[model samples]
Target: MQAWGYVSHQIPLLSFASRLMNKLLAERDFSGQEICHVLLNCELQEGTRVVRAVDCRPYEQQGRSLRLQGDHDDDAEVVGIYEKYLSRPALHGELTYLDFLANWNTSKRDGRKWTRWSRQAKPRVLYYFPRYKSNPQHHQYDDFCRVKLMLAHPHRDPNELRKINGVEYDSYASAAEFCFANHQHPDDYYGTPNAEDRRPDPDEFEEEFHEPDLLDEDWLELARQLPDCPPSQEMVDLLGRRDIDIQYDWTPHVGRYADPGIVQGDYWRQRIAQNPLYMDVEDLPSEARDTLNAEQRIVYDTIVGHFQCESEEQILLHVDGGGGTGKSYLIKVLSSHLQKLARNRPSPIWRAAPTGVASNQIMGTTLHSLLRLPVDRAFTELSPADANALQNKLRDVRYLVIDEKSMLGLRQLSWIDKRLRQVFPARAVEFFGGISIILVGDFFQLPPIANKPLYFDGPLKDLHEASGQIAYRAFNYTVFLQKVQRQQGDDQASFRLALDELRGLKLSIESWKLLSQRVQAKLGQRDVDSFVLIRPMSHTLDPTLPHFKFLGKRSRKCSGAARESCGQWRAL
Candidate 1:
């Protein structure tokens, strides 16, 4: 049977072992020629051994009553091979003969260490209690499966094993638990090309695939801005019959991925048609269209999607510009559009900024609050609990929007990626998916307090390198937003001036000196013509407020007069 290695991770341990045994046995065999018979299913009438060598078990004193897997004693390599099949570490030599060790036979071990399964039989759960017949403890506790029981055990031929094909698990929740323990998922086995027979029942698939439910607080206030959805009779029925929830992708609500071509081709033929907002891209008002400048337009077009869905890697929405140039405005405007996009689909979204100061304007909670990282926490792989909690909290959201992307540090970005992939292993948070992250900020602002600036060097760079795994995770994915819409036609001149300086776009040295001194000096007549740094703040209040917690005490020299008139800054 065909199976996706990744999704199979969600299956339970027992089911996993069973499936592993079946798949491994079916794929390879004891005899090279006989194996081909097993593969074809054409020579079923012939009696044949079901499986080849099993992983090892050594005997006491190198002598057991019988040889195993056709070896005279025990074949160390066969046992080692079994471990490798289970993805367990393999031993280069023999499995250290545990039977001869001092601890051997010290206690009555109840569980089976090695077992062989048969078709048409309930798995014979092997158990080993010491073979002490007349021992004092044997009288009190049942030590073995007595002959009475063994004699009654039913027997079946090897052909019956083929009947034990796919597992018939009871519940999706149970199946999910099994899948997780096995480090696999149902999706791995269900939709695989050769494993169609193993697919979950439609009802179970629905439960497994649906979008996660949303929390009441996750919605933006009064954000009922429905997307531009087209109406259709089939969609009307689908929406009317289903109790679909608007959720994000990391959690449970997500279903199987649908082809956009199928979605967009006869997309409208369905019950719930396209998103309310997916009409003619050209007819959108120019202001709405221009919100994504030339560069942004290129990114939007390159995304190759209609509405967002799950399973992708890396996402970068770079909105670069100076202050007040409408960078934040574009994001704020798109917030609803984003919400509508996620709401319209089956997958959910998780949105946050990389820093506290920046997060305040966007997600309402602090970055640490969403991440749950302690103040002194060092970045590491998220604990299973942390991963579980994050998955639970982040199930369904359409996108991740980070304000002040420029301030995001390496550790911060790494943390986000690890946490994201842990929860939604299919579509990593760094990747683009149903989520289209919009990063709003200027790179020139600041990097992390613990990381090097994108352009920083020396001390900062070395420190980041020494930070270990957290720093290593930093290498995942990267996106840089570019554009300058924040400044007005003339206001952007400030950045152009700086860019000019760096690119040898020059002004005389005297002009540069005059501009730098503006922060300390009053504007002279010549300075008036240059760019003036204006604070919307009034001149009357104490200047001390500009410095946090530095409000100066009220001072009165019998005749009140301003001690310093003012300081004006100039930029060329």
Candidate 2:
């Protein structure tokens, strides 16, 4: 491979072929021997400069005996391959490989299978190729830069040269011919002079990357004021309701200058009930409710009491706890109670999390999916049609339980609040659109990414962050669970202490020694089967581990040993 690497221009082609065969063979049940036979039989156009699969210039060898025509199945399979690999807009009406196959008889000379090769009859148009900005002499550096540039242009279309100067060609083929005639690479025509050949001028050095200066302040002061903003009609209607928000205080809404159905309060009670989970919460055993610890009971009772109330007052509560504190257990109990209260109506209790894995644990969806929240950006105002669709989708959702609150960033929560308000304009003034929201998770686990945490204090950056902080602060009550339910046994006291110290980032010598002892311990055969590794991404694990099962009993033994505390294994 290193020997062939010197032919740098062909490296990409080799890599592409390797990936193509790997994917093709993986999809089909082709053995390596069968693949080798296919490669041996297939003609390799080594001298051809292949830019695409279509450019491979395939030709049949003499007396190889061509497959009979009218085999629809084989033809269809070949067509499917072309469609998957070579069917791009540029080749839309051109004579593709399929067309060449159809016209094979015409191209054959005295029954010989070989055909004459020529440039494709494409439309005569101005051709463009990006200027290669690297020195070809330094092949390694140039190859890297070329790969980066190739990746930047994902779509295989010719670019429009902004300044054509005197270098112009009617087609790409003509340009290549001109380059060959001049005994120079086509890239050299437009490429900037190499570093050693040309030094930077004073004007180039003086170039500023900063934004250009704006007009004078007196001119900027003439900037017109934004139009008078007003809340959506639904918000006005919600405020007008005598049943809820009696004061009708229509103060201006905040966040992103933006932006369900169901009635207020017990209006959900009047609607026909249809349970989505297909389970009767009423059938849940009394022991489920009875098993709650004192701390859990307080939160459970407060939530249940609010659900049973006649008023439409929104409940925003946070259930804060550490690991193994029965927070999940409490959520299960509360979900059941909420279900029982809602009766036959669609379970008003919807659960969501910042991530899919966390949501799956509680039989919920991710908040982004559930709320149609934007990724990596602030939420924008939705179109009327989209808002209507979102409203209908979430009409029956009265209570939302968000798990893994620690992973929920300020910007994300702000998006949630903003989206909910837009969707249920009537409840726009209320935090999270007047829906009873229950937040459950340990802050000690993992903090939000690229954004401030829910508990972020100090100075605020922008109104976006400020809005989320305000929404979080709106939670009327909080329940803190301190019990370590999972590792409670006397035998696991040391493990519990270690976990506690680890969470607080104040690990003691005692905890460290306990962890060190485990590091030195060996795993038994039974331990290997029971042990499971958890990672945020599967790619983070050993890539070759999946191959262990295919290597038979010996590899199984190797994998088991690899799982042992002290065992070490590395691929050569």
Candidate 3:
């Protein structure tokens, strides 16, 4: 039957038959014809039926004729011996002819040995298939299968395994042992088993499977399973559709799992597309240019000059402005102009702020988030991979507008300088990666937290000098926005005078009296509903009033209602 099977498949077996006959004739002391009969019809059992020798005479005649061809001379014997095993099956030690055939077919379908099969099956075993296969009564057997899969998968997070299978093993060691005893090696089988075949139907196992909540813990667990690279645009969009709120702090972890370049590129591309910053110079909106006061116009002109200059000649600019000046408005104009110029390419203009709230006001991201700097460590301490990602992100950035610069520290600024230098090594001698940087903030508004301010001129300056760090010296141009666009007439003049006096620590009695007049009397009987009372200590005020309190704490309800009433109230 085996000989006929080979013949029907058109598989050449003349050489194999010759080698078998020759071996039997030499080793078993049997004639070539007897060997042929044994191969074709012998059952190798006493009293079993066997075919008559006459039926196998054809095969014996062919083998004997080939052997006779090898008897003439030494050269003929050598050639005949070579031809004998030329088409013979290359079976492994102790493996049968059937085993060799099965292995050959498997190797043809998949290259290499079972190594590839083991690797391809490992992830599916641990991640795709559930722990159990049969009914709940066969839970023990299912546990054995899961444990076997877990053993095959290296770098397996125990927590992830438990979460995926919805079962926690007492320990990895115990799980490994259980798998060893119950699960058979894949090599013991002919082919790789399908994960679905080993797993019960989804409907049958739905009750056992619990979907994890989309919480931080689950996100972290999922992140652990992902490969270290930036995610593709599709993955990011899918995540957005799912409304997974990936926090800024989690970016480093998430970034490693996906391709950072793709994520950041797609993110910024979408942001620029959605932004209203692409206007022609001639068609610049009146709101951007006409609304600026004289002081703001000068600051705007300086920023425009920097943008218009050759990239190599552009200088870092600092726009010093108090609370009421239109600094934010100027930044918008500059951003729009630059973005419009580079609409065909990635936007050269980028905005960042120290705080999330401040960044949100300008439709930008936190500086640390933009830089991908670790919150717990300095920017200089970024990992090599993170530093490369940061460099790639800033490679095309030409203009960076940093709002609330006062809150940024001298050390942080130096770190920024160092990182920029690393990104643009050719321009390391230049300031801020040879990019036009506009720092917008009033130095007197809020000093840097837990560090010396950028403008500090005391021992901090000496410390900076000793550390070879550049401070405000990096700014080649400075423009002050002095016009108080938020207030007008006596209110504006009086407020300026009070601020100046307070800054100089020389508040005169006249200045104090001028401010006190704005404070309404708390004890007096007043129509609180008709007019808003301005008290120094009051947290809540009437919603109809033009003036709002700027105490230490914010009254969300009162402020929200007042903001809703006016529809245009800018928080002081």
Candidate 4:
């Protein structure tokens, strides 16, 4: 194989024929040695280009017989021959070598035996010939091609030139034949006196090839046409300019705007018209004076004094109270008094709560809605229009009352303070925009979700210090509503004591036993009918229990009646 490597292409055609003869004999199960002539018919048109392979055959020279015989009138011409010694089988079986060869040839002609050489057509060849732009010698090829093609067809339109010259026919042969009359030399064509006159001027060519200048206005128009393209630099700068007063027409969002149903002017007007003399000091309602407990009276007096004070000092008050301490009743009295005082003018009192349900109970709105504060962003991050709107909203509001302060976080309180400061720059910087703000809630009620509470003195103090925000220090006055007005008598006294112990996280054995007594396991039908279950431990009662049906059905009916009857008994 090594020796044959040097002349591998020049190997004799008889070698390939001998190999084929041996393959054929092996395929036919032949074993003895035999000399045979093999002929391969290949059709070639021009020179060495093979058009197709026509046929193959093996002939026994001594016998003068063809192994694979067929009609000889075909147009395929014999191209070569291969003659060598090949193994042939002895004549023992019914099917001989001749019969096998005949069958194989028949299969090949019938299109069953397909060999690589027997393909009907050759594979297409892709030529990597030199294009005008790629050839270094043809640096000016594009210009030359365009000029020559145009001059050759002088009567053709501009559109026709683009269609035929650089784009349609990219070959140099096409350009030369069309323009130079088959002349191959580019330099000679350019040097010709007539061709020199036809050549385009360099200055004109540069001008024609240059791209158009795109101005800012042009780019803006283009951006408008193509929606996906971002705004250009010039447009962005114009929009970002502070001097441009871009008055945005903002729509009031549902949660951000106070409920129209509650804040309408007609509701306040009706209340004022119904009681024209309520604002007179002599006509003060007896309910305001009689209903308030001792602690609640102190809170009410502090709020009224703050409003009555004519000094520049702003008061920030927080009323610390637990559930059923008359905080809501106090708020109602303050609201009535403030509304009556400002009946001839705009209302000075603005009540807000953190939750919608609480806001509705106080006949006010959510704190976020009243101040137009964004739920997802901080007050400092408000847009110019939003900030201005907030300032206007806070301008006339003199008394701001925030209920349910437990659910509000330190950051939110700081945000409110910041917004107030922005609105009233003339007020003392220490207080909240010179407005008397009353915060009412128990810190232990419900902690703020995902943030630190107002009185949180945990490890997060450093975070508040870094932000330069004060939480508990903002309040100038604090009032405690310690009396439990809702509970009384021996049973109520015991219940209140147990609740206080639970709040302190110190559950006494007696308290646990008192709570456990309410959990009755089994009861008879008469007990179920007579049993008055006050407060169940769980929200869902055990439906499987025998007493559940009667208790569930009668408890709601009895509880309201029992509450009314219990209210009649007061502390001696």
Question: Candidate 4 has which clashing residue pairs, if any?
Answer: none
What local lDDT score does residue 270 receive in model 3, on the 0 to 100 scale? 62
Question: How well is each residue in 1-572 modelled by candidate 3, as lDDT tens digits?
Answer: 22333333221233344455778867865466667878899644343222111111111232331323455574332222112212233432223222222222232322233222233222111111223432333435445443334334322232333332345566444454444565554331111222223322335322542323423445688989988888788887787345455443565575463756465768667666778442122335646666776666655555554444433565476677777777887777767766665657665778889899888777788887777655675345567787688777776677788899878877777766666767777787777667777788866565555555565444443343323236356564556677777777884687787876664457889899887775446433454345665333221212212111211122121111112122333221
Listed per candidate, the RMSD to the true structure in angstroms reads 27.2, 27.2, 26.2, 32.7
lDDT by residue for model 1 (1-572), tens: 11223234433433445577889988886586667778886663432222222212212222233324644565433233222222322331222221111112212222123322334433211222222232223341121212111112111221111121255344323332333355421121222111112333345432332322533332554465657577888877676355453342435534544657565786566535544322111122325635665544433333323224333433443444555545554544444444444545433334466656675564434556676654575656678887787676666654566677555654555455555566677655333222445555655454445443332222333332334224322322222334445544785576555643432325657557656766436768776677667534221222212211211122111111112111221100
Best by TM-score: 2
- Quality of model 1 by C-alpha lDDT: 0.40
Query: Number of clashing pairs, model 1?
Result: 59
Regions of model 1 farther than 4 Å from truth: 1-287, 300-326, 344-350, 363-365, 380-386, 426-441, 453-483, 490-520, 524-572
Clashing pairs in 3: 229-256, 229-258, 229-259, 230-258, 230-259, 230-260, 231-258, 231-259
Candidate 4, residue 215: Cα displacement in angstroms equals 56
Ranking by TM-score: 2, 4, 3, 1
Q: What is the per-residue lDDT of model 4 for residues 55-156, given as tens digits with 9 covering 90 to 100?
A: 122122223324443487544332121111112222212222222221222223222342233354332111111212322255555544543343234221
The 0-to-1 C-alpha lDDT of every candidate, in the order given, reads: 0.40, 0.57, 0.52, 0.51
Better of 1 and 2 by lDDT: 2
Model 3: lDDT equals 0.52
lDDT of 4 at 456: 49
TM of each candidate vs. truth: 0.34, 0.45, 0.41, 0.42
